[model samples]
Target: MFYMSSGNDIPIDPDGSSSPIPDIDLSSILGNTLLIGIAIVVIAAPVVGFMAWEPVEEGNVKVVKKWGAASGTVFEPGAHFINPVSQSTVSLSTRPQAYTMSSQQGDGNRENTDDAITVLTEDGLRVDIDITIRYRVDSAEAVNFYKNYRGTDAAEQRLIRPSIRSVLRTEAGRLPVTEIYTGEGQTKLKAAAQETLQQDFNEDGLILETVQIRNVNLPQEYAQSVEQKEITKQRKQQKENELEVEKLEADRKRIEAEGQAEANRILSESLDQNVLTEKYIEKLNETDTVYIPVGGEGYPQFVRNIEGGSGQNSGQNTAQSTNSGSTNQSAA
Candidate 1:
């Protein structure tokens, strides 16, 4: 009743050999171990590759795609996982970018170049203008903008500049020449230009910052004429001012003269004729003697013969006596 340790004494083995009940191969175990290690490496390569990638930076977003087709969902900045074989991401900046373009000088050989734009005034005068536009990209919409308008170098060259230029020219064309130069007018024009640009560019995914007019170049002849006209106007105004001053002075002098004449007239009217006669007699008597003119004399004869009373009416008496002597001379 003894049992064999291997299949040696088993009924199933045709020849009794000193072997265990089940055969185990050390080479097969090692081969299986090697296959498992190879399988682990094959699976880990893609996992490691996926783990190593990072998404777009902060303040930016990644445009995710599957097999080159957009997923329509944006991925924010961080470490992220994507389909290793089919999905990908493209990052775009979400920051604002300012653009500045200055006008190029025309042929420098000419002394007087027509570096002017002809703008029409409301009064139909043609004026020259110089201006600048300052603008920036909108960060919130730059991601979409990069994908669409700035898709490639060709798009930027062919589309963006032309659009901006067209919009600017259209706005400038609508403004009058005078409005572009004056202070309040320039302010209004700038506001209108900014609004027009914002409306036009915003639809095309652009943001506008500001538009400024740097200079307005009127023709030299026109400027000189305006100055001369201003000078003439000032001179005329000065002459009118002088005339007004003279008129006021004349009126003042006339008023003073009239006032003095009225006072003199009132005094003359208030006096009695008898009082004037008495004043005349008193002045005559103040001469202290009298001269009588005789017809046969070479000169008037002097006489001091007022030998009447030295009474209170002496002045009146002298006048009367002179009159009586004149009557006697006439009678003789």
Candidate 2:
């Protein structure tokens, strides 16, 4: 066996054999190790810093913090420097985003689950309302939003959804189920809900663009009932319209009858004895035979008769006589 001494020198064999060990300088080893370490750090620092760089995308902002304390600096869309050892950046989008709550799978902001909002009306009915809300973080208030909510998901989960639900519940509770299902009432509800959400979002550093109630899910039984009620209401309205038309028709007939009666009254009032006598004479000329009544004992006695070729002349004479008699009677 060969053993080497601590003092760099020769190796001594146990069987009296000897060999020389290579001379190595400790200072050179230490210096070389230090140089390599410095080179590695110089090369790695930029790479690490580059890797730590946070990008604030378009329509977004990044909140930078140092040592877990907000640095009070918000970075706009661009590459920003951050200390890898003591700083971090949280990116928040400022673009308008839509969040939908729906029972169906494909229609909402979240596609993985059913997030429909359920509320109770004044009539104690459960209504599932699918709504889409468009909103965004106010760019000016991004820091405040970051400090308070940290991220969009947190804000949506804690603030937006809850506020929407609260407002909807309160507003919906004020309306009966029937009213909620009606067109005018539903429009009012949507407007009210949007107004309430707008106020809430304004206070929370968010801009609410729109609130749309996409669908309403009523209980099966209630839906059927509503349908039946709607049908009945339409039928009643139709009947009322028919009655109104009938009333108008009756009024028109009454007006026409009144006008005809007035016309007849005027005609009758214009008919004096002279006019009646003229009309009687005109009728007499149309007849070739003349019958004159001579007695008034409930029996008519024919006094004179005229016919044939001299009928027209006789009729004309009779008319003149009749006219003279009517005039005398009037004078009397």
The sequence of per-residue lDDT tens digits that candidate 1 reaches over residues 207-231 is: 6666765556656887787679789
Off by over 4 Å in 1: 1-52, 104-147, 151-160, 214-332
- Record all residue pairs in model 2 with backbone atoms less than 3 Å apart, i.e. clashing: none
Q: What is the Cα-based TM-score of model 1?
A: 0.44
Error of 1 at 182 (Å): 2.9
**How many clashing pairs per prediction, in order?**
1, 0
Worst 10-residue lDDT window for candidate 1 reads 295-304
Any runs in candidate 2 off by more than 4 Å, and if so which? 1-70, 75-91, 170-175, 183-200, 271-332
Among all windows of 10 consecutive residues in model 2, the one with the lowest summed lDDT is: 298-307
TM-score of each: 0.44, 0.57
Q: Best lDDT goes to which candidate?
A: 2
Q: List the residue pairs that clash in candidate 1.
A: 6-19
